[model samples]
Target: RGGCMGQCWYTAVDTQLYLIAPLLIVPLHYFKDLGKAWLYIMTLTSLIIPGAITNRSLSDHERLYVNETYSTPWCRANSWIVGIWTGYIIFKTGNQLKLKKWQVVVGWTTAFATGWMVMLGMYNVNEHEATTTYIIYEACHRAAWAACLGWVAIACHNGYGGIVNGFLSHPVWQPVSRLTYGLYLISLEVQDDLVKYSRKNLFYFTTLNM
Candidate 1:
């Protein structure tokens, strides 16, 4: 709620594990009956509950230190399907059905640009800003991202795009991507305060220091 990073992680939760974990597991084992564990994980992802038993004994309104978290498992399920499909399409296009060189360049660039547009479009906007529009835009955005990632993979497969792939494959992004989980864990707790404080004392911060 405080900073851009905090909000991004929340949205990422919805985009990634929320849909992803279930998609991955559902095909293998939970096809007939998705487990309670999946539901529980997605439920907590909304982060709306009062507090768990382990909560620091915080309370609100008429309830004890507990609150209700609400989410749509169906929506999450659909998103998971879409995410997987996007990846599938990219792979098929790049491998099974090859595109002409110029076409490859066009498709790759357009896909990449579209992905950035969606990602950046959602960055500053709070999740609660406009629920319906946000949801639709995000769905489109994520689909584009999947395609973008797939195209990059395709280019790598083609072998000549080594420079681009090499950059991405570099040790630099590796650590950040690998540490994403830890970053998510630590950043969320602190971002709320940091963002709030920064906004309150805007003059105190200079962009160069960031």
Candidate 2:
């Protein structure tokens, strides 16, 4: 549901992130259509995500986010915990040699499999699709990602040939990952507004959909 050109229109469906925010960001960034005002916001956001996600209290300050957090306890129990753990490990083992090629491959594969399995489990059983669930799920995903990236780096340390390593090490990954914050901000707001609008407007629904 949206006010298209100030006329209220109602719909039962709302699109997801890839379809929604990219629909907005791509044009803004690529076509150079955004006015000078948005440039400052985008630049500020790129700096905010890394640190915002790094610490837990940044989210704890807000009541809405506190309620929305999928991650429980928010401090001792979090993906940020994994981040702390990983950082400790890297610092402790900084001198150690990277994993052997076979070991790296197996580690990466295991990481990917575990990540997908965990996400599926969460999706099926977790009823709270709110902020809390999202935080926990994202934390899990981020931990898995850290493992995968760590292993991939080890795999590519000697030489890079495998498809996974090639893609991971691709020059585009850096830029794209940076934009994830912008994408996150843009998409979350858009989807929230879209869902709220739809839930309110589309009241006279048949049995076809909610």
Candidate 3:
């Protein structure tokens, strides 16, 4: 049932993570270094769990996509934990991250490299086959993607984002951001109904058409 909602599985996973957030957040607020260490451990564990599951049970790409690897909170916690870590860092630093020019350049470079790898590394992998490399990629990809996002958020908040921040923080996005939740909730069902009742076959596919 968790993964059966078409695109809405994200909502379920997010809610599950939200319910357990305080377990990390409360200690993080009160315990300082201990809380940071706990978050780091959890992040490492998040990576390990998916790798272990993939190695032990997932035999193919399709199986990996359909199985708990794609849906379960434990398997999906890498990004969530990364986000928490990012938030904690922001809070601890009072939203002021001062870095050298070289540090900023290195951070941006690393983030972009990780983001690209996560996006394109699977292009050559056989969809019907699984391997140790795929398992490692699957395990690290989500965390890497989240790390990229976390870096953007941190950099933007700290004024290091430059034009990227200008684009992202534009007022034009405010209304769209507000409507995103409603759009996400109904867009799939609306599309399904449109296809079901259409007079002609809906064959043409493109981002704008969809």
Candidate 4:
């Protein structure tokens, strides 16, 4: 049953990594500037090298298990690393980096473009069957997404986002943000159950319609 829920193992691994990574990096974090550089290098290398090796070495089933357990973390660690680095920048600069009008346009454009590419890839995954190209995309997409988001954050924090900033900063979103952690914990199970139930009823629904 646990294995039937596709993301259950990944979620469990994610939980452990979230708790343990910071503790392991505490010494590195103490160095401020150097720490940020080290984290950037480490997370980038973690994303690239391991994925390249795994893609070349592992059999399909073995790769799937490795992705669920090992590869997912290496890819996702970028998000945490980027978040910490961006937070530090915001703190030190008081989030005051002013951009040119063109820069703001470029930032938002890149964000939308990369984000939509990720969505498109996921939508087409069955067609691609996690080919080497798709595997590379999966490994690198999150980091690209994170980079785009960092731009969005910079634009929003510095008041360059215009309508985008207004939408993101809306008071209504605050409550939703507050619920994010709880929702994050349970969402995989909810999604799995919903998917299973929907698939089970599909034939019945189709027959009724017919």
Candidate 5:
């Protein structure tokens, strides 16, 4: 359980971000363009700091250190800031996104492409030889992932999502969504305990098992 408590760190990080969200959100609400500029600056800063730290501390042969790059609040802020940006846009538009047909087509195309790029772009890469490339990915990938999700959210909210919206917004998901927090809290510990106390070897691994 002690080792499995790593999953719980996100709750603490999320709470810290929620505590400070008003600092960013209030200005964006009241100041318009100036606040947007601040957000853009903050977004860029968030992207840079993680890469800078990785480059400074990690050798060219080393992978990113999880504690520094993955678990830190500042390193994880890029996605949170992107979410805030998406929410701000939705608020301003009154949840009515009106784009031309061509624009909608292009937005969905680009969103899917970006999502795939983030998902598969690292495959078979030689990280030890291309540490700089890994550093750049480390800095940008979370924000890119968030931006893709943001597009999905925007499109679904405004009926541009077609079948995607139908699947995501289906009533069947409501009860499952309610259990996600409890699942998140206990699933890791259960898995850890099963492995720790098992008397026999676990079943063979496969994608299905995963």
Candidate 6:
């Protein structure tokens, strides 16, 4: 771990095959049983052993090796699975859902609130965090985020997003959105350096740089 701590060449195991695994794992035929697959994937990824593996803090050795071997697809696959299913649903259902205005508003609002709570690290805010809760949160956070975005996508596709769709689809965001894939693949190096040697003044650092 020390040998390659700051080297960009030493890619994390989680990055291994990540660019291609989902392309292979999620099949178009699987969409034929979308509901069943959705339920199974959600339950396995959220309640099974693999879901809890990364929740525990890893030792240096473990971080360098074990995480690569055991945590990659198992721990992260739920997010992809849910996303695939959601896209299928949106494509198949289109505007046929015909949800009421209030329904869309309430559904998206609730999903957004739940996603925010999880994404903001609210579950670990306390000095004494519960292991059980953390495990559940770790397992479910990705699915929760995916679900929230799925709701937004559904609304946008079905013409129910109202203002949200207009804002998100604004032309000003097109260029930035195009860089999303590149950002996801490369930002870790820059972020790693900042976090690894940070001076501990988060507020000042964020204000100055972010």
Candidate models: Cα lDDT each: 0.51, 0.48, 0.87, 0.69, 0.87, 0.65
For model 6, what is the error of residue 4's alpha carbon versus the real structure, in angstroms, after optimal superposition?
8.0
Better model by TM-score: candidate 1 vs candidate 6: 6
Tens-place lDDT digits, model 1, residues 102-149: 887787778668777876876755655554444445334434565576
* Model 3 C-alpha lDDT per residue in residues 1-210, reported as the tens digit of each score: 544557788788899999999989998899988988888899899999998888777546466665568878999999999999888878878766799999999999999998999999889776756487888997999999999999999999998998999999999999899999889888878899998888686597899988
- In model 4, which range of ten residues has the least summed lDDT? 63-72
TM-score of 6: 0.67
lDDT digits (tens) for residues 71-170 of candidate 4 = 4666567666666666666766786687778887877888899889877766765675666765677567767777778877877788887898899999
Q: Which stretches of model 4 miss by more than 4 angstroms?
A: 1-33, 61-72, 122-130, 200-210
**Models sorted by TM-score, best on top:** 5, 3, 4, 6, 1, 2
1 against 3, candidate with superior lDDT: 3
Residue-level lDDT of model 6, residues 1-210, one tens digit each, is 333343332245346536654553464446556645655655464445444464545334255334442345555566766676687777678778788778977998898798878778654446674656655666677778888888888888888887999999999999999998677666778798798888675355566587
Q: With candidate 2 superimposed using the best TM-score fit, by how many Å does residue 26's alpha carbon deviate from the native? A: 42
Per-residue accuracy of model 2 over 123-194 as CA lDDT, tens digit each: 653365355554444445544555555544544554533787587778988989989756754665677789
Clashing pairs in 5: none
Q: Worst 10-residue stretch by lDDT in candidate 2?
A: 6-15
**Best candidate according to TM-score:** 5
Q: Cα deviation in Å at residue 192, candidate 5?
A: 4.1
TM-score of model 3 relative to the true fold?
0.84
